[model samples]
Target: MTRARLKLNTKQIRARQRAGAVRGLHKAVNHLHERSTAVAPIEETTLINSAVASVDEGALRAAVSYDTVYAVRQHEELTWRHDPGRQAKYLEGPLVEESAMMLELIRAQIRRSLR
Candidate 1:
């Protein structure tokens, strides 16, 4: 009678999994930041460049920010850029799509790790 034997280091496996999850999170955040910047209205380039993304350790969530004095004016500028009567949802639309994509990516990563 013969039996197969396997050796597993749980600590090492857990470390690798954590590293992969972190990498996936960082990738998602970076993707969001890039998408936001691309969709942002740019005249002087300051607003677009101000877009930034980071992961919150406490919440394990990705957070994005457009840290600029004129961040509040984003809506007004986008809305009135083409026509004052119609609102141009440049930032919000792209952000929603990007967020969905990022979520899907993370889910895929999780599935892959499980395999």
Candidate 2:
């Protein structure tokens, strides 16, 4: 019986994996942004528009920034729709809940790239 040999370019495979991971990170970030916006208390759309995502490949890290000046205030507020300080848990809650899904997304991307 003859054995079949398969050729694999390790460099190309690594590159594709990296690209796939980045793409997956981007998608996850966008999903987080959308979820944050949907749950956020909106006044003039500033916060919604301020939602931004960044990925650091070297560090293997991803983050979403609510760039508005009032982001902290809004998030930390104690009241909702009644008092001046409206407590809106926009970013943190969703991120924590969906963290596992983000990992799965990255894995899926890597799998696709390998294929």
Candidate 3:
């Protein structure tokens, strides 16, 4: 004879998932920020250093930003030139290129949280 029972606390699971997602998103955004920094146009270095990665827990949203007056211009102004290996769309380029890895980061965190 054998007996088996299962009980699932969905509320707890959801909380775990939410926490995991937030953590994962934070990590992903930070990585993106770092990647962007590596490629961001550098003068006084403010643009590259202003990089910030944030996750809104309430909205379950995330963003990576460069808080500089010239950030948008530097990113959008295709006419502009930089030294050696730096150019426009630093943030956008890395984000687009690494989106899959970002998702994987989130997934990995969620999987870890479940265990």
Using all chains and alpha carbons, the TM-scores for the candidates as numbered come to: 0.67, 0.78, 0.93
Local distance difference test values of all predictions, in order? 0.68, 0.79, 0.89
Prediction 3 global C-alpha lDDT: 0.89
lDDT, candidate 1, 24-104, per-residue tens: 787788887777666666678787677788986445677778888977676446435632322335456666778788877
lDDT digits (tens) for residues 1-115 of candidate 3: 9999999999999999988999999989888988888889988888977888888989978999888887898999989889878879998899999999999999999988999
- Tens digits of per-residue lDDT for model 2, 1-115: 9999999889998899888888888778877877777777678878878888888877667888888888898887757562243237778878888889877888898899888
TM-score pick, better of 1 and 3: 3
lDDT of 3 at 45: 89
- Residue pairs in collision within model 1: none
Off by over 4 Å in 2: 1-7, 57-60, 80-87
- Among the numbered candidates, top TM-score falls to 3
Query: Cα deviation in Å at residue 88, candidate 2?
Result: 2.0
- Among these predictions, the greatest lDDT belongs to 3
> What is the full ranking by TM-score, best candidate first?
3, 2, 1
**Candidate 1: TM-score?**
0.67
